[model samples]
Target chain A: MSIKLTIMDEMARVAREHGKILAPLDDDLALLDCGLDSLGIAVLVARLEDKLGLDPFTTAEEVQFPVTVGDFVKAYEHGAH
Target chain B: MSTALTDAQPLRARLTGATADAVFFDRAARVRVADLVCRTSLCGGRADLGGRAVLLVTASQLTAALALIELDGMVRRLLILPPDVDPDHLGALIAGAEIDAVVTDGTLPPQLAGLPVRVVCTPGIVPLAEPPRACERTEWVLLTSGTTGVPKMVAHSVAGLTAALAPSASAEPVVWGTFYDIRRYGGLQIFLRAVLGGASLVLSSAGEPVAEHLARLARHGVTHLSGTPSHWRRALMSPEIGRIAPRYVRLSGEIADQAILDALRAAFPRADIGHAYASTEAGVVFAVDDGRAGFPARFLNGARNGVEIKIVDGCLRIRSPGAALRYVGGAKTAALHDGDGFVDSGDMVERQGDRYVFVGRQGGIINVGGLKVHPEEVEAVINRHPRVRMSLVRAKRSPFTGALVVADIVLTAPAAAAGNEAELRDDILKLCRGALPRHKVPAAISFVPALAVAATGKLARRGV
Candidate 1:
């Protein structure tokens, strides 16, 4: 699967298991405005790190946290490249 | 004047006529009573805060802070504010307490600059004025380690606080050290004990690495050292633990689990390693010196010195002449005490064979090391996220800190579908980091379908 697809799938799984998402997934959505919280986000990151074998937040020398869904995906994409 | 008024000696009477040299030693300098007296007189005169509410921001300079405390005791109602407190929160505290002056070491936060309180920055002597007469009833207002909301101000009289302290055992003045800062209750107890006993104190600097702190204690030949279990754990982890050979080692602030007690015994076989049960409200309750985790069960309803202890419905209750008079600006004295005057300690104890062990807090407060963290406070912050339906904060056992904070969160459906949980978590953490102190930050975050609620319509905290 593509990195974007994998990240999305993990996010959906975490959300479905913990809380319900009333709207459609999109890049423009502010992550904080979404239903997920810090713990849910942490689970998603751990899943992504497991599959991709890279955690951008932990491995990066200086990590600027991504505020939006698009920026988050971009962070993973940059790390992958 | 009443007999009590005439009988009450000035608070400075504790420090009067001590041997003129090496009274307080830190990494940088040695302070004498004469030096302290002169400085105190100069500060008292310069600040001229006569019987006003004075907020003391120690900023972890133990020597200067102690001197300021001595001065405040003489002429002002001292409010000891922790050095690590958030500046904005501190401003609220200062305003709430109606502080008239501030004595600090040149590091006052910008938020407090505009306050009407007189600011006396330390290490410089101002021109001296005639010293004012000390009050017969000097109040020392301390802030409770608020885990849920704003910290409460607890008022204690100087005489009542020092009433229970035992005189120094040895004729030769001993050297004392503690892991707590002078602003904190536990550290203040040690400071008062050292002063009342006529011993010199080695004050630990805040934010100094544990290895360096331990090295300093060793270099200064600290004979009696006291710390929380967490502090000891950090000290044990340090490579320089072998440097200090104290004659007495004490543990307080957190539950003294068997593992920590055994570790201390192994580390300091010759030292009298003991753990004490004490609180800001209850003063020093009891000390267990048997290298055990819990006190004997028989201590219930037992009187030690002047303090009495008993367990009420699994909660430890204490009645002492030295107990804090009342929580200032908050709860009344009646609300905290029983009909007979025993203060509800808010700590839950469990019966373990012949001993009673402290399990945790009954009031849903999480103790991370010796510091208190309220779950409601963290939950309130997490619930602010637009997508979050609710959040539950709890403590998980940790080796580094005694307990690590973890948050379980429930999200809104649309946000869940967005599949951006990682980013959401980071954002939430950032929000908490910006708002809460470092120790109050949640170490781990996890997603939950729902938070359990009790049958009585309250959030269920059992088995967390």
Candidate 2:
């Protein structure tokens, strides 16, 4: 699966587990507006790390915390490359 | 005990008005205090194991307690070994403490096979033909918990251990209970308290279920209870928490945060909630009984004997009469206290408003992007959430930051949280964000069925 799809799927699963629904998985959606809380985001990051076998926060020379869904996907994509 | 050990004086000669109420209870049997006046812990083997460094390894705390009472003024030095000591460190501890005799409960572990003398205690009240007589003042040795390889053995005089315990006035029948094994420092304090007050003590086994333990305590009508915050947190989660409504609830061996204090207050409405600040190396420090989190800043004002406190490099240092006298065995250095006679307790604290609240251990900080995060600080914040039953904040290795703060938490109600994990997680995150610094917030939080509490009744910290 693609990194973006994998991230979105895990986010949805985590939200369901938390008894909440996701707002939307659009690339332009700000992370703060996502149905996930910071703990949910953290759980998503851990899940993505297990699924993708890479952590952009650990691999990339310089990294910034993502502001949007697109930025998170791009960071993972860049680290994978 | 400082006066001098006499042939006529046993340890309990200090307790004057002892009626027939005091007894020690385990799961299997019970021994009354009045019956113990004539009987010896080592019933038959007391003759062979006299006047030497005696290592006591008991299967039951009941035996350990009775043996201590009998061995106080009879032997040269008596080391009470907790059942959970690492076997690898046994050889060194035996040789270092110069253990020539051992008092055990019928069975001896293979590690202690080479000891010169082994006496088996049955926790019975049978009179011995020739009971061990008091000769030398027995120095009591205890082991400090070791995170790495081996624990240090601390030596204390009988005078030192009982310095802070004032004899209980004959007011009401006070039956005591503890989650701690009687061999450890905290539990030993409670044992001494029971002995001093001529009261009964309900002992806890190592791996006993919380419900069964609570039921047993209720059966005994336990009135005074003491344990670590971790023990109380796990106990509060059980439905059997209402079984025994203790008149006094005490917490020690860890920092007592605001959340646990409040929880105990609400659960036991009529009980007086108190958390004592006692160090293993340092003696018993001051206790906070005002239902507050940390002690008042004014506690540091007076330079008294047992209550003296000084903050050197943020670590709380104390000089008290209740501390360990010296380090036994040659495993470590000779100094139990500092040059100024103060035991430097490695707990760090911060002055917030009118109180000095604990942050974390001095060597227990997580360096996250050059910012120090105290695990206890994060744990205190995480526990404030209503959904959290218990939380252990730990450092997870991270290449981005030196170490990332992560938390493993147990839910107060697992069945009630089937689909409501997201809201609870959100509430916890919001609480942490408001209370803790950004770096101190957990990078990841996982809901575990239960957190592993050590044999010391503390939240076990796994390797980072």
Candidate 3:
């Protein structure tokens, strides 16, 4: 499965658990500006790392933190590769 | 009798004659009290800082700072400056306090060089002069952690400060260990208690790695260990944690969460794990020994263990002899205290069944890994950016650091028109990096539509 799809699935799972309804994933949408709070972001990251086996957010030294869904997906893709 | 005459006894008088050989071991060297006293006296006399403020720059050498503190009445005041203090901040502190001399183990930093003050090195022997008159007015000025902007200077009389401490329960001498800088309040309390109890302290160097420091504590057979919960958390992560077996373990400087407390108890089954509620303003408050997270709620409105704990409007208020007399440099203590003289501890608490647990700061201060960071202070800096309209700073839960700093910003109309959030975030981060300390800088920045203000007409602080 692609990193983008995996991240969307994790976000969906987190939103479901938190009872938060997430809008459909879009590249330009800011992740934080969405329904996901910091806790939700953390949970999504953890779950994605479990399924996809890489977390660029934690591993990269001088990471420019992802602001949008596209950047978030790209970070995981870069780490996995 | 006059207060000065009654309280002006030499600090050395507290030490027993038989314990003259008790050692203070640091990473560099070990020195006995007998030798340290003689050397400090010599250095004190030659420096000739007769009744003037002297800045004692300490660099992980607890004994050296202790020796200078032992010269209680010889100097007017001793401002204990930590090694990692920002040079600009140090200069401001010195100038604000009107420091006349500096006594340090090593060379003075370049920021302090141009100041018109006498510089003297410690642990050096010089020709001794007649001992200076014992002035009881000698005060020890400690700098606050300065999580806000500039560190506040807190002045405490030696007599009053020592009077506030609880007497050591142990009759036999025990080896002590602490993860606090000797200059700060938590570390200073342990340092003073260990010395007065005639115990040997294995001083941990701030510059050393956690593993090496824990190894030294194990080698010294440290029986009593005190540190912040963050410190304990880091120590527990180190493999060397198993090497040291402390009989008494204390957690202070941060809220002692249950997980950390439980982990500590499991790690050292034989140790008495307890957490004490203390602040730089209000000295040592009550300590909870149930190996739990918070103190019993009954402690409120009741005097237990000779200390009074009261809850006034959901804020923890304490009245202790160890509480600081007043804030120096015209900072008002009126707002910090009530009409009845109880200090507002700035900590908000909630009753969890029979026990009271710390929720967060009522003052909107973000406690990032035991260091207090005022959100307003960070927000003020972020808002100063030309492109920024306003900012909301908050604490984010971090596994490594107890809490990490994060900021959400609202950009100005002109800047928002640029449509480059990434570049704007980087610019704000760079601006903060230059103005604030590394820890105070926001770990992550997010752009938001608007910051919410509560009905009380203040920025709503979201509790972690």
Tens digit per residue, CA lDDT, model 1, B126-228: 3334443555356788776644456777878777777677776676557889887657777788888776676788876655677888999888888899987
Fraction of native Cα contacts kept in each candidate? 0.00, 0.15, 0.00
For model 2, the superposed segments whose C-alpha errors exceed 4 Å read A5-81, B1-10, B130-132
Chain B TM-scores, listed for every candidate in order, come to 0.75, 0.96, 0.75
Q: How well is each residue in B236-330 modelled by candidate 2, as lDDT tens digits? A: 98889988899999999999999999999999999989998886688678788999999999999986555688999999988887878888777
Residue pairs with clashing backbones, model 3 = none
Runs with alpha carbons beyond 4 Å of true place in candidate 3: A1-12, A20-81, B1-3, B17-20, B37-47, B114-116, B124-133, B330-336, B363-464
TM-scores for all predictions: 0.66, 0.88, 0.69
Order of candidate numbers by lDDT, starting with the best: 2, 3, 1
Q: Which ten-residue region of model 3 chain B has the weakest summed lDDT?
A: B452-461
Candidate 2 is scored at a TM of 0.88
lDDT, each prediction: 0.69, 0.82, 0.70
Better of 1 and 3 by lDDT: 3
Can you write out model 1's per-residue Cα lDDT over A1-81, one digit (the tens) per residue?
Answer: 999999888888767655458247689888765666655565566557757877777567765677888888888999998
The predictions' CA RMSDs to the true structure, in order, are: 13.2, 5.2, 13.0
* Top candidate, metric lDDT: 2
Ranking by TM-score: 2, 3, 1
Pitting candidate 1 against candidate 2, the one with the higher TM-score is 2
